[model samples]
Target: MHKYYLTHLQELESEAIYIIREVVAQFDRPAILFSGGKDSIVVTHLAKKAFWPAKIPMPLIHIDTGHNFPETMEFRDKLVENLGVQLIVGSVQESIDKGRAVEESGINASRNELQIVTLLDSIESHKIDAAIGGARRDEEKARAKERFFSHRDEFGQWDPKNQRPELWNIFNGRKRMGEHFRVFPISNWTEMDIWNYILQENIAIPSLYFAHQRDAVYRDNTWLPASEFLQLREGETIENKLMRFRTLGDITITGGIESDADTLEKIVAEVSATRSTERGNRSDDKRSDTSMEDRKKQGYF
Candidate 1:
């Protein structure tokens, strides 16, 4: 008899694929929430693999914050073009213009929280019964409490106390007419596992994750890219530095860390030796201890 074992990366891949397939089986209309981040890129890759030979059955939903890295938008457009999948964009700017959401004021202002309204609007408009996201448990405390299949109420609110149990790897996606589910296929993957899988699979990600020269300003202990949307404080000055993003979000809130790990192998090695959580530099989470949880409850993906 011969015994064989799947590598940890392979195991994670298998689980993610199984969860994705389950989403297809359980939901009427499902879409992947792609933000051009490495995690979402990985989820899109797995979705490709999950239904290989046949085109991805569902479309991709992007809640465009309008405050994004140019590199991320370029990569997102190219990836969507290559995949031959439908792309539905929910514009936050449009939401603000219509008075659906109000933009924040002051130096630390970000469109992060405003995304909740736009996302919920998009879901209702698109009639998306299940929205598959790339959020993982290891990234934040709020995400840590998420189930593989998280249910939402008629108004798209998440109730952590009323979650369904998934013992024995079985998921129950049963919901009422007005309710929906947020499915996280890569819920079990960590930052390290993501980088390792990207390296192993030679996946293509945005250049923002690689070390490059950018004009940035030091704010709240993180290097924030000095974009046109950023309002400079009285004493703050932008300086060019070799920086890279561990995670990608809105341009204002997604901070970069100074590093020389441009290649995938180097990123893997760097992540392995790091002591901080990947979301440590994300200013959105730093607002309060329950920031992410509060946002999640209001249907922010």
Candidate 2:
């Protein structure tokens, strides 16, 4: 008799693929939330592989905070064009213009929190019953409590204390009308697992992830990119530095670290040895310990 078992990476890949397929089979209308970040890129790649020979079964949805890095926007457009997939952008600016959400004020203010309204608006407008995201449990404490098939009420509010159980890889996506679900196919994969998968798959990511020289300012113990949207403080000074983003989001809050990891090999090695969480550099999360949890409860991704 011959005995065979899947490796760790293989098992993770298989699980993710299975989850992706299940989303398609279960939802009336489904979409992948593509942020043009490494994690989302990996999820999109897995989606492509899961339905090989046929184009990905769902459209890609992007909630534009309007503060995204230029490189990230460019990568998003190019990837969508190349893949020939439909892209739906829910703009925060539009939401603000329509008086649906108010922008945060002050020096450290970011559009991150306001994204919740726009995201929910997009989902309701698009009639998307399931929104697949790249969020990983290991990335943050709030995310750690997420279910593979998370239920959201008619108002798109999440009840963390009232989540369904997923024992033996079984997921219950059943929900009534006016309600929806948030699916995370890569929920089990960690930051290291993501980098390793990206390296193994030769995936293309945003240039922001690689070390490069850019004008940045030290703020909140992290180097924030100096851009037109950034409001510098009284004592803050801008200078050129070699830095790379561990996580990407609104440029106003996303911070980069001094790094020389220009290639995937170098990045993988650095990630393996790093002790800090990926979102540690994000100023938005620093606002409160339950920041993500609070936002998530109100339908933020």
Off by over 4 Å in 1: none
Model 2 Cα shift for residue 45 (angstroms) = 0.4
- Which portions of model 2 show Cα errors greater than 4 Å? 1-3
> Across residues 1-64, which tens digit of lDDT does each residue of candidate 2 receive?
2558887888999999999999999998999998888989999999999999898989999999
Compared with the true structure, all predictions reach lDDT values of 0.92, 0.92
Candidate 1 lDDT, 29-143, residue by residue in tens: 9999999999999999999999999888999999999998889899999999999999999999999999999999886788999989999999999999999999999989889
For residue 121, model 2's alpha carbon misses the true position, in angstroms, by 0.4
14, model 1: CA deviation in Å?
Answer: 0.7
